[model samples]
Target: MKSKSFKRYFILLYPFLMLITLVLVALISNISLNDILMAAAKPLTSPFYRLSFIKEFLIVGLLSVAMNLSLSMGEMNFSLEGIFHMAVFLSALVAIYFANFFIIIVLVPIVLYFLWQVPKKVSRGDGNKLIISSLIFNYLILGAINYLVYTFFSDENISSAVTKDFAFALDMKLGVAIAVASLVAFIIFAVKTSLVTKLKIIKDAPSILTSTGTEIKKEKRAIDLCLTLLTSVAAFLYLFLNYNRFSLQSFTGYGFDAITVTLLARGDFKKLAYPAILITYIRLLSLVMQTEFSFVSSVMYLMQGVLIFISILEARDDRNY
Candidate 1:
């Protein structure tokens, strides 16, 4: 009962907490209040800005959906950033020689194969172990990314060859459509399938299920594959939306943000959209800060760390509930 109350209160208080954090960050960074206000108001004040916000929202929104699938099943997939990056980079390479449609064709099988191979090496443990293993997997992907960057990819080749020849606004709209469909599919799967019940048991009482001859490991892998599948589609659409905007500099923090969004929404599919909008707005505000105040990315990361810590606490409380 106490756990339930605390979770409810925390969810209600989260937006205010984020608002306070932003204000504190602004004050500490010596940024102007007016600048922050203007940044917050941009999406509301302009159609182009609104559309741009929605475009960015779709990327992280779909990602949260994907990540939540694994997270709700007691997995924290830090490897999603690596998976998303790999998908975009490899597909962009294929795009150099083939049509965009062919990229989708190639991505699906590659993602499936990668997910298939992942469990062979990294045994799925509990949540913390899953996090550590995912991080390990992520770093491995990063190592490969570094080698590929050195050997194959560059701004000149990627930009001139892979980024053009596509309609940006059209692809953005297509991404939105696909994201809506994914949400519907997620709802049906949750409500209509027995997998949801099985996943709950797998998370809470794996031994009981195993005693009944349930395939716990197989069930977990199935969720992981579903996660990869959703993330792969999101990756391709994200690449289409921001084709020239990426680099091999570092893992884009979109994956981490997605996890945070899912946590903040408490893995509720209906609530996920709300936090996605808020997070995306906060993210855009951070970009504006970067330009206007020379705000450091590390500061934003620190704030996100706090949010994640709190959300993890809430997740723990949920287990108690």
Candidate 2:
């Protein structure tokens, strides 16, 4: 009986597993893996390069996993992209005015609270409602920024039109390092918290836990809030600090990448880390491919989105084992 049950479960999981394998194979084949490996193995490589890549991969993966976990608990937080852009704007503003680490740290939470609360208020506890409200919020904020940029910050003298003084103090390397450190600290704290532990129990025995009703609801809210706040902070740091370096020229592609990372991890942080790293590498590889072939990058994004959509649908239908 036990063997039959296990076999049945494996059969159900096979297609999903195969899909993941195929994505990996396709991504791997697109890049010059051997050449990249050889380049990395060179003795003259910079320490910053090695450390920054690991830091960036972990931070992005951590944020994606955190957001997915909040969504799993039915928290409507559709403001991630907006919050990310806001974080960049706020960071730039703060860095310009203050340029002190302590001030930025103090302000980050306050900014995140406002960002988190907007969706909570608008959604009135509905996830879909929150998503819609957040999307609207994103556009409104973007328009405001563009207006400000053009009216005051536009250097009539310079071609780019951006204010030179308004740039963020921290670059990609420092931003990624700070984000990775914060993620590590959050993971440590989360492990010690009662909410995650209680959720584990409830997840293990929903019927028994649901009998208590109030306790389960409280535990669920605690977990969702914690995850949402953490993810918001991480995304904010990534977008804010790196925005100037990477063109905010197109956010649609990055937004899709965020969705793919979230789906691939299935809201599990540990599993998310590996996939995040793989996805980042795939993206880097995609850049190389784009230089050689005009349409490969567009094809890569389409493939990623389709795979994630299928994965989410399949996960919804299958019972968690």
Candidate 3:
């Protein structure tokens, strides 16, 4: 029984183990103690970088929870990446040309409403269709957005636009408050609500719920809206915090990163914070390494792959037990 419990909670320990591995790797790479200390202290020493990281943590955390909630019901919304990016991009463009910061208040809902309709019309409550349609939509949307950015915006124009009030629409204190509240609210919705029980039934035995007159598609559409709302807010907060340093090439692949975090949490919303913190730590560390130690950018991708691999191995072990 003790061993079983250990096995069950081992994922919570995995992040620390990865941290140790990173330390060992640093040592092997001739990183001095002072360099390590400086890297650790860098974000704290720079206010802007620190605020950027805080925003990243909140953004990624919200996305992870949203993804986990959807996956719990056997659906995956890959279009979140598109929605997250496009909403902010459109808002920024409007703010740049029209000089109106509040334009995002209109743009966000419009973009989300458009995206929200795609999966609903295409999938009709089938999880597999939702996955395929969202994935394809994600690619098309991202490609089109990037093309427009590359075509119309020079680097200087992009820089000027980001430096304007558009990015800093919300003061830092208010932004932080909203981000924290959003994450907390979503967690409670996932863990404390009765809707989760219905979602579970839908996951494990959809036919059982269908026989009892449960509307599987309706349940899924509700989850879909919740997810879009979170992603939209996350994108808005991200623009407020990081848009000053944003780039046309600034996609974070966080849509997929959320998947790895969710898998590590083993479908438990209560454990979601652990994996979210773990992924955020890895991201911070990756940035530190790249900027301070001159490490290659691909190091972050490698670390992400390692995390998914470890999660897969643990998942296989669980099945055996």
The CA root-mean-square deviation of candidate 2, after full C-alpha superposition on the true structure, stands at 6.4
Shift of residue 61 alpha carbon in model 3, Å: 1.4
lDDT scores in order:
0.67, 0.54, 0.68
Give every collision pair in model 1.
none
What value does the lDDT take at residue 127 in candidate 3?
53
TM-score of each: 0.82, 0.64, 0.76
Model 3: clashing residue pairs? none
lDDT by residue for model 2 (99-149), tens: 674655567656655665776787775545665686688667667756665
Q: After superposing candidate 1, which stretches have Cα over 4 Å from the reference?
A: 106-109, 112-126, 157-169, 189-192, 242-245, 248-251, 309-321
Error of 1 at 227 (Å): 1.2
Report lDDT (Cα) of residue 143, candidate 1.
Answer: 79
lDDT of 3 at 159: 59
Summarize candidate 1's per-residue lDDT along 82-171 as a digit string, tens digits: 777777666666655455666565566466447534733575455555556777787788678667755655546454222323333245
Which candidate number would show the highest lDDT if scored against the true structure?
3
Candidate 2 TM-score, true structure as reference: 0.64
- Per-candidate clash tally: 0, 1, 0
